[model samples]
Target: MHNIPIRNLSARLVDPFQREYYYLRLSITDVCNFRCNYCLPNGYQPHPERDKFLNVDEIRRVVRAFAAMGTEKVRLTGGEPTLRKDFVEIVENIADMENIHTLALTTNGYRMAKDVAAWRKAGITSINVSVDSLNSRQFHRITGEDKFDDVMRGIERAFDVGYQKIKINSVLMKDYNDGELAQFLAWIKHRPIQMRFIELMQTGEMDHFFQRHHLSGQLLADKLVQQGWQLQPKGRTDGPAKVFSHPDYQGEIGLIMPYEKHFCTSCNRLRVSAKGKLHLCLFGEEGTDIRDLLQSDNQQLLLQARLFAALQGKREHHYLHQGDSGVRTNLASIGG
Candidate 1:
């Protein structure tokens, strides 16, 4: 069966990037469990605080509508996706939709110790766990919660729950965790996890880190090469990470340069934030608010208008222009 629901709209679906954006990211909540320095503002902007949020049933309807509009892959995200009360129910509901091909989630993994099996039972086959440091002290420094043991327990539980592939995401910042890149990479080697080294974007609370220290993906890949591991490049795809592999290892590693450049022009995905806002571009300041439409269950012309705006919002590329593209926010709010 065709993964997209575009049978009615395919003829009009002229992919500006030569392929339809097959991926959809649905942020179920903006609330996270960790107080990562790079994520929330000091102690002021806590995770439990509400800006605007969506109900589980409301999110299911939105995903169903997206499935009808030709989206096939859906990944649930959040400040921490697992924090939502009906997190597993949301996953199961989306998985039951025939149009969705892949269902995934990215999380901080601090809360998955006991719930991992339940998460798997909900039909999630893959997971990406965000771990910036393996060192306990440094880890606590970054997340403000020395729940390293908890995070590791989650990883173990993910494997026990039968998650096919697990990728570990490590954000590289100068002096902070950059010194531990090789350590982090080596830690995941031979394991069921792919190690991803992400460059710190000058967004969110990470602005403090960006000004204080810096590093790049190219540099990290080079470091791996020096350690006698062959960095084999994987061809680009709509998926987030720009993948690479180690010749002798079973996992992969990657870098996503959202600030330096975005995979936009060819961008095929759109984000429905937990707050019921449609963000076409991760860096796009404008979010088409569909909260009212979602609340009223209005599937009128406005729905199509929102889709049009989302498509029109797709730029040939992100504003990685040398000086001042003005994306100072961090990945926390965007659900990366």
Candidate 2:
């Protein structure tokens, strides 16, 4: 229903640094089923309070405010967003927004084979699935799940259902899947998939694991460049991945190196936790609660005002390089 001109809406989301945010990462839930070694190694623990995640109405209010303020892309994320019974309804609600041109999902691929077609019908424009390793055993070891075949089938199902291109996210770790770059590249050579190698990031609860397995994404990026993969320019709402393409292959490669210098200068996205907290930075301090203002559709102006005021406090860059992970205990908590 927001018929506001794009030019006017764009100015409202700009921060003091003059960076305009057009992307929003909204987490729908924090309960994940998989126990990834680097993230929720012990699986998701139910909070004592059992806090309720944002309902459909709340989600609509949040999306409405952001869309009205020039957010063109909205990504539905979670510890496992598909776990929600109303997941499809959530997608439809956001898809109904006229201002949101891109509706994406970041999933673990556990449900892709069975639910992807339904997801596509509900309006997910893009999909990114986490595939830590190509090897079945290695994937099981890294993710603590024995669903490698299931995930692979899910990818195939996505393509069979008309998805032209899919993005695969792999978290690179030392002595782990780090040696499988060539294997990954070869697999994606003829496929329309973007294989993204994400550097293992340090979090408060996983410092020991991070220290043991952290691998630099730059190594992979440099290797790709040397192999004739040309770097591609990023879109305004693109994530931090440095994408590269090769003339000989139908696929592409993306490197997400958070440790690299000037990593946050091109930031165009903001994150909101499943419980309605606004996170200025992925590795920043505690989030600012914006849920109170999301109670009603009439709170749109106040919500936007709170968002603009909060954006001013966003630091230019995260202190991840200085061994500071801020208050984030795990990536799944904030839908990272």
Candidate 3:
């Protein structure tokens, strides 16, 4: 597609609330193999009527536009991004862009042991793996995958490669893995991993499940503070995680509490679906299609104009606190 000259692109993507976006989460696919109870309990279903996900060229054009508009970080997400045969090629294409400094990835970690080194060489600067529970049985119950040992091996394999520190994402749920926080902390005490605890968020399809299992992340934050863990300041491109560090532990704790007051104040990221639809917020309205503008390099100016117009309508914050999850039925579809 398009490779508009970088110098010709001079506008930065900013919202009405004055939030300048510097990070872009681009989903490569919505097909995940794991059956996480919270996200895709039944497994990923393909819609025959929908168009196919973005190809390498289309993705390159999208990232190019963002990079020229001052987006510095790009996170390659998916139901599992590595599942694509062209995943490495996609990584290489974006990694070679001019203004994008950080090329990160979020995965389920099933293939990390087999393909991490190749990914590192292709320009993946950081990795975040989903490790819901330390207990094998509990993890299986949560993810519906019996490969917990294999996933843990994959993490160790990551360390063996060149990753100085890896981020671990765990969705905390009531009466599920909530009681195992101590076990998680002990495991990461001597490691360089950042354990991120995300509160279970409600989606359109998971109302009853949310009512049954949702837990507040503030409780964990309060506990950490009482235990002498000091809160760390966030970086410009950091996600919505309140990180905590301790004097004795090598690892850090991050709390992602969507229900917390002013949780969206530090919002600095935007999302684009696998099919090239820009999503203004995680829990906002349906996405705006931009695939037509990605077909040729001549459409770069129009695509940038469309992006700027869309940002003007972005809501100040997500409606999660008001019991509204917007059009999101599951996180997998939007690369959450």
**Candidate of highest TM-score:** 3
Model 3 CA deviation exceeding 4 Å by range: 1-5
What is the lDDT for 19 in model 1? 51
Report model 1's TM-score to 2 decimal places.
0.87
Rank by TM-score (best first): 3, 2, 1
Q: Please give, for residues 197-281, the per-residue lDDT of candidate 2 as tens digits.
A: 8989999899998999998887787788899999999999898899999999999999999999999999999999999999999
Model 3 lDDT tens row, 1-336:
334467557579988888999999999999999999999999988978788999998999899888888899999999899999999999998897988989999999999999999999999999999999999999999999998998899899999999999999999999989999899889889999999999999999899999999999989999999999999999998988999999989999999999998999889999999999999989998999999999987778888889989999999988899899999999998788
lDDT of each: 0.71, 0.91, 0.92
Q: In model 2, how large is the Cα lDDT of residue 169?
A: 93
- Predicted structure 2, TM vs. truth: 0.97
Sorting all predicted structures by lDDT, with the top scorer first, yields 3, 2, 1
Give candidate 2's error at residue 21 in angstroms: 0.2
